[model samples]
Target: MNSNWFKLLMKATRVQYGENLKLNGVPVVFNKQGAELLIGDNVTINSSFLSNLVGLYQRTIIVTRTHDSKIAIGNNVGISGATIYARTSITIGENTLIGGNSKIMDNDFHPIEVEARNTDIKEKIAARPIVIGKNCFIGCNSLILKGTILGEGCVVGAGAVVSGVFEDNCVIAGNPAKVIKRL
Candidate 1:
């Protein structure tokens, strides 16, 4: 669609996309009901990964995880082919760039403890918030787990799995994405 037509269509549909936001690709699909999705200004989405996110939604998988969550993105962010599910909250700060085929999660659907994982039912599941701060760049095929925090001006390398609180202005890489160097 043309720029003007797209704007009009989005407005008419009541999709709360912010100003100067360009959506180049399709969404991954809404997995569960009451999942709040919020985006900010001047952003771009470049790829599609519907299959990767299918398990998170009730509509796709037969034995699906409960996913009434919220995702919040700040201004001037660009993302490509990422599968994200926010059980509580996954907040991305301003001026952040997320690489292709990444995964961000704030919950562990299955119980991790011996009793919880084995048993059919558990009192509570584990979930932790993820925060990516301003001016950060995440590399391709990275996996960011619950309670993961990336500070300002941080850069994550390709094919990495990041968890826990992280400092700012550093280059991190690897399976368990570590700090390779400071930026």
Candidate 2:
């Protein structure tokens, strides 16, 4: 196949693609640059099989968020149709499987009050960092908001909106997501 198409993909990897980098027929687009996007070895960031981590740019450059950001995906990760719109930093740990159409953000992007949102206040909230631990499985259509951390082995149910820190191996769901059960 054409490995030239993967040069951009290779540059997108964190740790300078480390020892081994694997992308399987994936369509990837970057909104901005001067930031590192780290994807580890044996990780399939495939857009053909499942479209995850594919940035939208309307054939030009689809940006989910307007700020330059850092997105780090660790080893053995499987992301399928996940949208991460970050103005700051987003780190996902090893062996995590992010589901289809899930939107994750590291910043609030806007203030609670309408007036504050009109100015630069939202930018303050948008600069915070987000981290997800090892072996977590986030469900389809889930929205993980800014400043939220999911501990190891967290399973977020479909269509859930999550904020704040959640316990490891717990099943969380619903709006403003809560722990439903522990796995």
Candidate 3:
């Protein structure tokens, strides 16, 4: 199939998308009932797998499992090969850049306790909101977990696993990421 046709088919699947939502490329967006996926204008998504092209296990997957779940992406943002799953809410502000193979999620998917884990995957799920503020840069192979509030202009280094509330204009890196520098 043609690229444009593929994009049009994908666009038909989104719950809500704003002006110029496909400025760069198409993104795979999935929303269940009571779930809302909002995308603002002039968003650039260069996720190869999302476009029905041959990619190396890469795709832009956005899923809101529950009815109350939401995934809101602001204008002028660029995302590549990212996976964003929301059980509550996941908001990415304007002018943010997300590198390839990155993940931003608002739910733990399972409990920490062995018994609870053995019981069910959603038994002890701790879902929270994830907010990535404006002008942020998230490097490749990063993980932005539940309850993470990245302030404006923050930078998350590659291969970092981040959580918690971080102030504006700083660099966060490492596993269980910490502020490495102030920018």
TM-scores, in order shown? 0.75, 0.75, 0.87
Q: Which stretches of candidate 1 lie over 4 Å from their true place?
A: 1-15, 31-35, 48-68, 113-123
Q: Which rank order by TM-score, best down to worst?
A: 3, 1, 2
Best by TM-score: 3
| Counted clashes in each candidate structure | 1, 7, 1
lDDT tens string, model 2, 1-183? 344556555455422444355544444446454565655776654444333434322111112244357777788877665566667778889999877667777766666666677775755464567899999998877888888899999999998999988878999999979999998
Sort by lDDT, top down from the best: 3, 1, 2
Writing each residue's lDDT as its tens digit, candidate 1 over 1-183 gives 454575565445333568787655345334344455667898776543442332212111011124556677889988777767766778899999887777888778767777767884544568888899999988867889989999999998877999978898988888777888987
Query: In candidate 1, how many Å is residue 59 off?
Result: 16
Q: Residues 1-183, candidate 3: write the lDDT tens digits.
A: 454675566557556666766533545667877688888888777766544232414767788888889999999988887899999999999999888878999998888888888988674888999999999999988999999999999999989999999999999999989999999
Instruction: Assess the local accuracy of residue 130 in candidate 3 as a C-alpha lDDT between 0 and 100.
Output: 98
